[model samples]
Target: MSPTLSPSPFGTAKTLVLKVGSAVLTNADGDLDKGMLRTIADWTSERMAAGCNVILVTSGAVAAGRSALGVRDRNLTISQKQALAAVGQSRLMQIYAELFATHGFHVGQMLLTAGDMEDRRRYVNARYTLEELLRRRCIPIINENDTVTVDELKFGDNDGLAARVAVKMQADALVLLSDVDGVFSANPKTTPDARLIEVIEKVTPALIEQLCPTSQTGSLVGSGGMLSKLRAARLATSAGTHVAIANGKRPGILSNLVAGKFVGTYFPPAPTHRSQRTQWILHGRVSGTRQVVVDDGARDALLHRHKSLLPAGILRVVGTFKAGDLVDIVDSAGRLLGRGIVNYSSAEMDLIRGHRSADIAKILGAKPYDEAIHRDNLALFEEVTSAR
Candidate 1:
């Protein structure tokens, strides 16, 4: 029997990260909605005054920049989008500053990339900075370092970043403010009969499959869609942080969520808490290019058997990566199994693939470990064995 779903306890949330998306922050004309921004700031400040630590993860820089530049090309070049982010980030921060100042709140801008989270030292530094900001009673407004991130190092969407931040800060809850009311049985825009899913007890493979086939498209200005929010929720929930997806335009949405009002789709955290290292291993947001493919036997051993991946199980090494680098573990059919720190470099993996563990030293004259990925360094998801 399946466990019953329950609403997340937002009222009990002491540390919160509110992620406001670009679609909700911008008007139909792609201009930043100053009024809505101010409203959110007022709500956030009220919470902070009540002794709650609120960190905001916002997305509207590109949209704001496009409006500021009067450029209408929706399909922008990589460099063009970076340029837009560079110009619009300053404008967005200025607006946040002015609006937050109205409520006597000081906002500090924090831009981060996925690479920063991968590096243990940098991750610690970033965490300390955020802690210091909260200690000083300053709200940290985080966004992707869009100006400098290339395709290789980008977090892709602020939703993913917000989830990572929530885990890093050990936040009690993550509220994603979107244009929609909440997650529905289907895409509400497409399915007229779609019903809202008020509570999600678990983020499973089946749930994700039901979301949408249509690429999770965002506002005319944003890159993320509803799917991204669900992904973020999964990341946070694994770390025992509750999550909510609600409409940013809804009146008093922020306060209402904190009041435990039914304003959005709430996802409860997992019963067992995941360690910080495990969270990073599972949801470090490793790109597709870094995935490694293994055989069905390897997949079974890792999932049902709970054993480490041996060299003989590796079917194919997908990308260039060194030992200690995080890589996705996928099956022969390219379905993602999980993610882990690779024990062997890609070049070395190629030489040892499909070879017996005992043959490792014979082939390369060096064998760092018997397992290609040790169980200690690995984190598995439900998708590892879920029906494709």
Candidate 2:
């Protein structure tokens, strides 16, 4: 649904997952945005008064660390970044506590790693903790655990994290507050004819290929780009959560979206929600013991037809895995297609690559099934990315 400057766009959202990117939290000078932080605290309190529950996912700890340590270089190594996050997280929370406390509300901190959301038990525990925090009229402020998260554990940006939280919490809406206004056909700064796409009913790979090539990852202070936000939208909207991407730098942008003022790009939720297992399979760290590389035909079948992955489409397997383990499916170009449980071991798949499904028994002398990965066990992203 498109908002026409009316209050109906997000007016009915009882619980909202709001993510503030580093672009809004860190100033151009790489310092904390004092004024913006204060404004958001007040805005959040006001929303609560009107009976809206908000789960705030934020980014800025590393930037805060940079400011405290007086380091301006953006090329810091993984270890350096972790060290800075360790120092800055405390300061960031302190500032937030003071700001929110002034409004007669308390705040709770939640530092999460990719593993927290990927594991079922940890995910449920996190949700229960958040529920209690909100029940006590406190805001839950969440951030990725950057201090010890390196390599595959890192979220790279908070956009994906917010979407995962929104899905897990079954939030009514999600607002991504960033520096940009919304999604566009191309880079508006460079393309004279680029136009804003106000309503995105569904995010598709074709749309991504058309609009995302020129998207810059982020400014020095932020880690996500237009493509990242779009990918996040694809994940959330597919799982029955509404989403909006707006310019947080603009005054009252969040309120405008909440009030249905039509200030950003909006995506309506899917007609039906996917099963919990589907959500778990689709939205994790995008991990598997290995990535199963597929031919173009196989990628098409999995993505477009929702068909089973067959031995005919297999190209090469990138990692080792036992049967019944999740494995990433990628095209030859290394773009992520999806992930699913593999019926055959990595060694078995390597032997059967590029062969017909009917020949599986002849080649291996044992055929568990004709399909390598069944459609029921696979989940494909509507938009493709080089994320993993």
Candidate 3:
């Protein structure tokens, strides 16, 4: 379904996920931008007074670490970075606690790693904790657990982390606060004719490629740039969450954006589905295993409409996957058809390969069912792809 572009239904949204980029929250020397944080806190407090639930995903642990260590070196070891994060996290929370308390608002710190989201049970638990905190009228401040997260398990940036948080909580909107005003037709400073994209109705693959080139890099303090922000917007919007990319430096921008003032680049919400199950299958989790090759019939059944994957249509299964594991469905030529949760382990499926539904019990000794991957557990990855 095509998403529609329009101003947000003002003051109606209950929950908002605000992502503050490192560049906006930290200086070139990797010091925290105290004034900017105060502005954000004050604005968030006003929104909370208006009965809005605000969840902040902030990036600055590394920057704060650098500042604490008085290190101006561009190339710091991973251990050094982790040490900095450990030292700076407490100081960062102290600043936030002070700022929010001054406004008579209670704040809670939540540190997350990729592992938290990768496991389904842990993900649900984390969501419950955040929801309870919001229910108690306490703002949840989230940051990557940099002290424990190495390169592999890290989210790589706050933009991606915030998007995951929005998806997890089923948030109403995602506001990405960055240094720039919004998405531009071209590099704003270099291209004089470049204009700001006011509204993005749909985030297409072409748009993703344009905003995020393959070699694009981020600032020393920041990890992702407009590319990551665009991907985050696409992810959130597809899950029926409205997104806005705006300048954090602008005073009162958060309030303006939330009020549907058309402050920056606004991405409209996708069609909302009543069933969270369908939504989760369509967009919630990423596939864990590699591609699963199927025949054209299987591809048509899945893409054209909702249909359960049958073993008869299965061609090949790549990757070592377990029962109930998420795997990508691909065509005979290796194009991604969609993603679905397998009912049988890879080993079992290998033995049952190309077998009829009637012979499943004989092949595997026991059968979950005729279908290898059920339709209910499958999610399609058809949205904009990250150029990164």
Candidate 3: where is the Cα deviation over 4 Å?
1-11, 151-155, 272-275, 282-289, 381-388
**Per-candidate RMSD, Å:** 3.5, 4.7, 4.0
Q: Per-residue lDDT of 282-304 in model 1, one digit per residue for the tens?
A: 87756448877999898888888
lDDT measured at residue 202 in model 2 versus the true structure, 0 to 100 = 85
CA lDDT scores, all candidates in order: 0.83, 0.82, 0.77
Per-residue lDDT over 1-388 for candidate 2, one digit per residue giving the tens place of the 0 to 100 score: 2357454546678898989988899888989998989988888888887888988898888888989999989888888989888998999999899999998889999999887876667878998999999999999999989887785223365888899888888888899988878988878878888878899988876777677874454556776777778888988888899899988998878667766875679888888668766887877764445889898998777766668999889889887877876778888889877788789999999999899988999999988799999888888764453232
User: Which of the two candidates, 2 or 3, achieves a greater TM-score against the reference?
Assistant: 3
lDDT of 2 at 317: 89
lDDT of 3 by residue, 1-388 (tens): 1122334543467888989988889865668999988988998888888898889998877778778888788676777878888888888888999999998988899998766765567778999999999998898999989888775223355787798788888888889988888988876766798888888888866798987676765545676688878888887887788888988877777667755674588887777523444444444444355557888787777777668888888888788878866677778987665667788888888788788888999877877687888877776555412210
- lDDT of candidate 3 vs native? 0.77
Model 1 ranges off by over 4 Å: 1-8, 72-75, 150-156, 383-388
Instruction: Judging by TM-score, tell me the better candidate of 1 and 3.
Output: 1
Could you tally the backbone clashes for each prediction? Answer: 0, 0, 1
Alpha carbon lDDT of residue 217, candidate 3?
57
Give the CA lDDT, 0 to 100, for residue 149 in model 3. Answer: 75
